[model samples]
Target: MTQNKAAPQNSVETYTIYATSNKYNRPPPPSTVALHGMDLIGAPIDIRNHRFFHPPPSHLMSTTTDLIDKLKSSLAEALELYPPVAGIVEVNEKGEFYIAMNAENRLGTPFLVEIKDTPYVGDSETLSPRLDMLLPPSSSALAVKLTQFSCGT
Candidate 1:
């Protein structure tokens, strides 16, 4: 297996958010109360790191604005299939924790589209320090960030 090394910081000029998408095509219906074993496994913490990256195709490239638009549109469509992801978790009056599944998310997902201005370097980097900052505060259950590098990645 090949380990991907971090890209040289010299190539990356800066990272900035150009747009935000918090829209869902259709509101999610009220869902039944439920609990997850994983949610209970630890000391009731829910922060986990699962990161991956795909380098931009060498041939075709899209602008940052266009990439953000496409991502926003795709997220709206995806919510239709996975409604729960758009819901929230809460504990009932009885003091038992459960997921509300109600489509009533204050902000569906703090979806952020960021742009990284850099020279067109063929290779890519993983585990960027800025990646952590891109995520919203840990209060929300779901958060997403789509970063488009200068190479239209």
Candidate 2:
């Protein structure tokens, strides 16, 4: 696993946000799971899993920070159970790819939080370009982002 770094922010954009990795509290047991032939065949493909939620009500808005903190903590705990999510795919000397995990190298999952001053009105069903902004940059395994809109959605 390699050290995780936040992608550079674009000064031109005004959204307030920050990125960080949510690592397991305790290192997961060491293991290397080799990818099967079928897995390797689809390795080059770009697959994304995204989900969005409605913003909290104005009365509960004050807990936004608490909500984000809870999310990060829960993600870390989940990584402890599913260690492979915290692992990275790497090419071995044989040029074969496998998910590698060890105590020495823990590449945690990327977690991002963004606050948009505008309401979110993008069509969730259509492949709208605007929806792409909700996800973190590409990673070998997993990435998550939470976007909160000011209009409460």
Candidate 3:
């Protein structure tokens, strides 16, 4: 004989829902997965597959061409360090070369260049995402730290 399951007399009443309520145990600190990006606002430690956008020059070799090249290199090197970026850098129709971080999404905002490809080819003074840093590895440690910050994040 097949048993027939009876429908609950009430919709929510069938479930106590205590797990979602205060009765639920506070989750233990994330052990295996340590949070990173939540400096305060609880942003994910690492924005995996998160695409940020920036636009490039109307002309590739314009004042912004150098900027675009830097973006490409920074992106490539970042991919080396953070291997999840399994995509290519794209130069869109408007002449802005941005990374195709995802299929439907483009990274960086209009004219807001990211510092993935730009390097510090320096007399070695400072680290501007766009400008070359003058200091070598020996001369400045902070230069490396400052330059390491992503401009668009």
Candidate 4:
């Protein structure tokens, strides 16, 4: 992960929510298995990485509320296209992990959205290295957390 020049004063988790794909009723083909049991290499690599998105300033909406609203809406649509992410990892009778698609009518719940407030400090020395504490892990197949800087940058 890239380091940010501006560390936060502290992060306070303010909001959280569960979001599903816009179209959860549609199921994949019967033969479709979102993910087959992971192999040694794949499982190790997957466990080591976490994906997060931070769009460029130019792409940001007028206000934080607008940006958050668009993000939530776009997320639902994106999940619809990539339905496998909405599926859960479970073991079969033979004891293997796999992404079970369409086994349930609803997509995984609690997409963990968090809003953080960081205080402004006159000098960089006051910033804390607690940015990583903004979001906690969720059981949902997907999660999103939004961190707001004190300067709104």
Candidate 5:
């Protein structure tokens, strides 16, 4: 990852990109999947799952490109199996929420790579100040973020 020359040394920086399934893979049928009763139970609540991983050995992943490539590839393959994850959440005419996807125009998942100048400490009880920036828009069905610390953890 290239550093931004204008950014402050201690400020957090992020690179945003999109990842899509392989073009050769069969696309999902163009359809609208309505949210059932169980799905509607938590419709008003927003929840996110955050995961962190320790850096691999230098020999395995020596550069940031390798890490980003692997992640994008993996996510693409996963999308092939679960196409709904790449869909957008939309409201129907009757005020019902559903996932919508088009075979001809696939909406890829949002992928973010955050570079931190400092080493990562354990998760704190308090929410992060940049939490809003780290998450995808509410309309998106899925997203992924990879945070790389200067200390490689």
Candidate 6:
């Protein structure tokens, strides 16, 4: 098995968080600051930084690093080869995963995505599985801040 997989260099992932109905039917936005996975202010930082962590029993930090490399490579062709708004990984939540953003992400509209687990997240992080999405341009970059995920494997 490979030590770590690399992410596409030019690939950009994105996540769509729907706000509660009472809260204007919006999940979380870039402004909604939160800890763990509650923030919806922009894009979930967790999905951006580290989608998942290596399983318990250290010695795979290198694997995570490799994920980054693979992600970069994936991005280079995302705009033309893959879906403009695609998810990167799967997480504890059923629908929680990374979303790839290309030239298709729009503003002032409800953006929904289907997240999936990548080989990288699967090879190194927890068994639960999680995704790391790439985002497109937003009306306000602040409206789509990324925090990178955190986990204990």
Best by TM-score: 5
Report the Cα lDDT for residue 18, model 3: 9
Name the better of 2 and 3 by lDDT. 2
In TM-score terms, candidate 2 sits at 0.65
Judging by lDDT, tell me the better candidate of 1 and 4.
1
Per residue, candidate 2 scores C-alpha lDDT tens digits across 12-131 of 222211222335345436678888888865325334555677756757756877777767777767766777777767778898878777644455666767665556687453322134
Error of 1 at 54 (Å): 6.2
Candidate 1 vs candidate 3: the lDDT winner is 1
Evaluated against the true structure, the overall lDDT of model 1 is: 0.50
Q: Against the correct fold, how does model 5 do in TM-score?
A: 0.71
Model 6 bad stretches (over 4 Å): 1-63, 86-152
Put down candidate 3 lDDT per residue, 1-153, tens digits, no spaces: 999764323111111100112132443221122213332344213221223334444475454446555655554444333322332333445644332334233222211322333332333323222244242211211111112222322
lDDT of 4 by residue, 66-133 (tens): 87777667766666667556555555677655655554633443333334355433334223322343
Give the local distance difference test score of model 4: 0.48
Give per-residue CA lDDT, model 1, range 7-98, as digits (tens).
Answer: 53433222221112335444435574477666656554434454435554545536445555566667666655565565556666776666
Candidate that beats the other on lDDT, 1 or 6, i.e. the better one: 1
Ranked by TM-score, the better of candidates 1 and 2 is: 2
* Model 5 agreement with the true structure over 54-82: per-residue lDDT tens digits: 87778999987798888888777777667
Best lDDT goes to which candidate?
5
lDDT of each: 0.50, 0.58, 0.30, 0.48, 0.63, 0.32
Candidate ranking under lDDT, highest first, comes to: 5, 2, 1, 4, 6, 3
lDDT value for model 5: 0.63
Task: Please tell me which model should have the higher TM-score, number 2 or number 5.
Answer: 5
Please tell me which model should have the higher lDDT, number 3 or number 5.
5
